[model samples]
Target: MAAAAHQADRPATGGQGCRAMTGGDRDGAPGDFRLTRRQLCALPGSAALLGLLGGCAFAARADAPPLPSDLFGGTTADPYLLALRAYIWGYPLVRAAQVRQNTTLPADPFRPRPPSAAGAAINRLGHAAELATPLMKQGVAPNNDTLYSLAWLDMREGPFVLEMPDFGDRYYTVQFGQADSSTEQALGQRTHGGQLPPVLIQGPDQQVALPAGMVGVRSRQRYMMIAERSLVRTPADLPAVHALQRAMRLRRWVDYAAGTDLPAPVSDQRPLLAPDTRCPAPLHFLEMLGNVLRDWRPDAGEARLISGLRPLGLAAGRGFRLEALSQAGRAAAARGLADAEAAVRAKTFTLGRNVNGWSVNYGGSVFGEDHLLRAAVAMDQIYVLPAEEALYPNARSDGGGQPLDGRNRYVLRFGAGDLPPVDAFWSITMYFARGLMVPNAAGIYSIGDRTGGLVRNADGGIDIMIQQEPPAAPRSVNWLPAPPEPFMVMMRLYRPRAPVRSGHWKPPAIQKIGGA
Candidate 1:
């Protein structure tokens, strides 16, 4: 509600800064000056005077002021902001719709809120969506887009259950939101073999909600969702209303490239809620600020504002500057950015993973016939090499390579025999370090079995080039552009066999070739 309210009050400037222009005519040069040769000869002594007047006149022109610039000096900041806002508002609807289409939930109820665990899970998911926005924008990987449509099905009314359908591999886990007092209790029984059940985890009676914070595992191969929780109700009534609250607030984390290393942890404190249910005014203002970044065109002033971000410590790498922000300002911006990135990342990753899994059930009808999903699903499994393994040559065959430098070429080679075990086909796709499509001369971001014209090496060994520059003619076919900075990759396996599914068929580690 606070987020919505803030969005309403401070309509996004759409990236137009406070100093933006309101189109007007330029002031012409002064009318009194003369420059004829005869006049010049007669007024030699007055030349200095004319030059001064000319300078003043030029400075006085209406359009003489310099245009503003963006923090990274990029011109597309305005459009990027707009895209971000659209992503934030549109993500939830997309996820909810997907769940409705794929899962077998009973018809929507009048109130629709289920039990306490159900509600809490939904709310947690929603908060995760909010936190994911910025991370997604920065190119965090598969988790970036997957959270959009992913949901934790809570069947807690009778036998407590939580189902995460798209978790990689046939891998699924269920958990109890509350602890069981007795091992013999049905609540202690696993709904699905090896899976935990959902339980009612009660918070303090005086607590209204969780303060803005982060959650989820931070891994290149894992999807994450972080957010803030502020809804408050009596502990006794929590179970009754939890489901509805979660349904209304569910969100996902999204990352465009790979997940980021975790930031330093903040103290864990419950956020206080206003007496009224409405969000506070400062939050509204922040939302408006976000809107301005998204909707308004980047004018000179807007550019200046973006450019000032780094100095103000509000830009990427300057997150530490958050400490300097007013408590309220810091809380609002940090929470907002985190939520946005997380939501987008979760949606993207869920989609990518599912798409790769060839789970026709989850692919929306739109992609039912598309080759992309088929190609994604055909691949057996994607292995994410640990940073150390990826950097060192002898750490692990699955992880051997030099440390990943922001700039350098890397090679991930898979022998035909080592190909992922899959009943269908498979391919490897590459995204930018930021997780979006990379800008390559060939416009090809990924390579897979579905790649129609690929020419493989004679040795039955396929070498995929991961670097900033295009490979030589022969190797170019396997080249996947790396971001000018650090990035991540996901290898998908479709219809994976027991070997691939059971970890017997691990992916080869990405090896560093030459200096970046």
Candidate 2:
């Protein structure tokens, strides 16, 4: 759909099933267990559209007319078809918008700095440890184990080279993605095994150098991102981590080869990508989808979904124009988007396996073929790493299956040495629905082994206080603050050990401290 020419042979269906490539190949399997996309489209009216959203949300309409030979494809498409098609297409696009919107901030790095200055940010280099800012709002999921180093690539300027540091014995990762936020590739301690390698990324039209010792290479979309995570153990570890961060550089291919000096930081901020969270609104979401379709590379099998979406002016370059649709068509399109949002919301909450109030997921973060699941997870938690890298055991309730809110006090105690089994480090971070990080007095957003002054219970066990108000002094030492409103907790186990990965080391339930 984009101007960038992608390999026409990139595998249409990811061998992965509904989740990531973790599952297996799902060939011409029924759209949702049905015979074909046509069968899925045969449902009766608008309700059918809602019901079959996950199955073949973007599959071409059952008896829909042919795609236009050009952009002005006239449509007799009813509201229901528009709704389903728009919703399915908008799902992933909204994530792209959300990631673009939140990470676009000036303070968080990923700002409009030129490629040469990418490695030298505000004097801090390509990565930062996030020492002081109590990050209250962020688009992507936050991990306390590792401080962040972010890079947003505008590949239109030509290909760039990412210099990877040999972070030996440390947990670090560079997650690569397109504007649509699909995790295209990974580089780090996990993938490359502590190798310091110069990586080459080829842009659509650029003459770039292939550096020596540049161990890995790949091609990506015009607008891309590389989110790097550098593990930081404590305040004492900050300086050393910063040193590692300073050494990592992102230079344009030509500059590195010629040792060309980088330009000074450029001017002013960009416009908003998406205003609201969850990207709940329909029209704006569809517009973002139209924008993505104009540039995102579609796989071979994705043609069917695109065929369905094209009629709505959401094709590669057509762009979704609400005015282009008739009054009834516009209304139907809105209704369809609304339904799709509702369905996506439902699926994300209930999709994973429920265990002790935690929706413990091993996969589904890295989307491949299952666009429905991809959209659902992007809504639930964007930029989540695949299980092997790290796993987020997310929870919104306590052990008794009661909803978690700061109105009540709670104690999550770990039996001696039972604190999340992991090789690198583990942390429990609290976040509210609207805000990404819970606002607390201590300027402390997360608690873990690295957190200072954590007190242990009598027998080497630990009690983590979870409540709005402060507990008495001694007990408060282990306090991980919570929002006064409904809150959720995330337990991230970096470089998880076999027990945790094998499901043998289940986390202790967040036991409510008092009935009151």
> Clash totals for all models, in order?
106, 1
Maximum-lDDT candidate: 2
What C-alpha lDDT do the candidate models reach, one value each? 0.30, 0.56
What's the distance in Å from true for residue 388, model 1? 29
TM-score of each: 0.31, 0.73
Instruction: Give per-residue CA lDDT, model 2, range 1-516, as digits (tens).
Output: 000000011001111111111001111111122224564344323232323233432233222122223321234456556556556445665455434433444445545533212222321224444542334122223445566676656665546677766788877877765555456566788767877577776765555556566754454555666677777887688787788887777777667667874632422323223333232233555666666666656666555566666556566655565556666666666656645654554455543666677777666355655555665565555556656667777777789887676778999889898888876678887765322456677776778877777888889999999988778998777888876655677788776887877788888888887654
Checking candidate 2 for backbone clashes, the offending pairs are 83-336
Q: Give the alpha carbon lDDT tens digit for every residue of 1-516 in model 1.
A: 101100000111112122111110011111111233344334323343233223222112222111123223443323333223322432232222222211212232122221111111222332222212221221123221111222222212111112232221221221111100000112111223322222222222222232233212211101111111222222243332234224432212211112332211111211111134233332332332332233222336434544444322233212223244455544544344333433332223233322212211222112332322221211111111111111001111113322333377777777867766664335454433223334556655446665555556687877778778888887777777765643446554433566655445556767777774
